[model samples]
Target: MKLRELRIEKGITHKQLSDDIGVPVRTISRWEKGESDMLLKNAIKLAEYFEVTLDEFINF
Candidate 1:
């Protein structure tokens, strides 16, 4: 899924969510821009933080 959708659906800003999950804001931007892939650890953290499954996060 696209980062824009995830961020909007989770009601979080890139900076805020990244900070909450101990990642860099730039990395989040890269993910949004398709410049990087999500790491499994970060994906798990995001799912927990957003109360979603990895499939949901990936919008599968």
Candidate 2:
């Protein structure tokens, strides 16, 4: 997933993202690390947060 890349590009820490999006920091970490799958709702939230389409968020 492009989670880590996008987060870095946006210059935001995982904690900052978690606080803004109401996700747990660990969950964000897991998603970034490919250790777990994000729920669709959470994925949508992230896509919206990053201002990207879902396909770009997940695959680009």
Candidate 3:
């Protein structure tokens, strides 16, 4: 799933996700908009936080 999709499905706001992942909401916004790439560390953190696999994040 896309970042936005995962965020929504997990009932997490941009700010919440950012706080959880130690990033700014604007960064999350960029991610959702496909304007930036997910680095390896952040991607792993996001996957772990969402209880999803890296493949789920990447394959979407």
Candidate 4:
């Protein structure tokens, strides 16, 4: 699933996700929109927060 899809499925907003992962809200928005690449550190954080794997975030 895309980032947006996963986030919505989890019932969380972009700002909430940013807070969970310590990234800026804009960056999370960009990631969801495919406007920017996810950095490794941020990806790991996101994966952990969402209880997913890094590959799931990148490739699912």
Candidate 5:
């Protein structure tokens, strides 16, 4: 799923996800907007937080 869709499905706000993932809100925004790519480290953090595998999180 897309970042925005995943976040919304989990009922997490941008600020909340940012705080949990230790990234800036702008970074989350950029990710969801497809303006930037998430580093592997950040991607792992997100996958863990959302209880999904890297493949699932990335929809790959």
Candidate 6:
């Protein structure tokens, strides 16, 4: 996923993102590591948080 790249480009840590988006840090980490899948709602939240379209967010 492009999640880690986007988060780094935005200069925010996982904890910061989790706090801002109300997701847990471990969940963010798991998502980044590809160890877990994100729900559509969380994905939408992330897309909105990063100011990207859902397509852009999901596209590699």
Q: What is the TM-score of each candidate against the true structure?
A: 0.81, 0.93, 0.91, 0.85, 0.92, 0.96
- lDDT of candidates 1 onward, in order: 0.82, 0.91, 0.86, 0.82, 0.88, 0.94
- Pairs clashing in candidate 1? none
- Which digits, one per residue and each the tens of the lDDT, describe model 1 over residues 1-60? 666786887688988988898999999889889899988888878777777788887783
> Which regions of candidate 3 fall more than 4 Å away from where they truly are?
none
lDDT of 6 by residue, 1-60 (tens): 589999999999999999999988999999999999999999999999999999999995
Residue 6 in model 5: lDDT: 87
* Local distance difference test, candidate 5: 0.88
> lDDT per residue, candidate 3, 1-60, as tens digits?
488898898898998888877899999999889899878989889888888899987876
Candidate 4's clash total is 1
lDDT score, candidate 1, position 60: 38
* Per-model C-alpha RMSD: 1.5, 0.7, 1.0, 1.3, 1.2, 0.7
lDDT, residue 59, model 6: 96
Candidate 1 worst ten-residue window by lDDT = 1-10
Highest-TM-score candidate: 6
Give Cα distance to truth, residue 1, candidate 6, Å.
2.8
Better of 3 and 5 by lDDT: 5
TM-score order of candidates, top first: 6, 2, 5, 3, 4, 1
* Per-residue accuracy of model 2 over 4-57 as CA lDDT, tens digit each: 999999999999999999989999999888899989998889999999999888
TM-score of 2: 0.93
Q: How many clashes show up per model? A: 0, 0, 0, 1, 0, 0
Task: Name the lDDT value of residue 2 in candidate 2.
Answer: 84
**Residue ranges of candidate 6 with Cα displaced over 4 Å:** none
Candidate 3 vs. true structure, TM-score: 0.91
Residues 1-60, candidate 5, lDDT per residue (tens digit)? 498988998899999988887899999999989999888988888888888999999893
Residue 50: error of model 1 in Å? Answer: 1.1
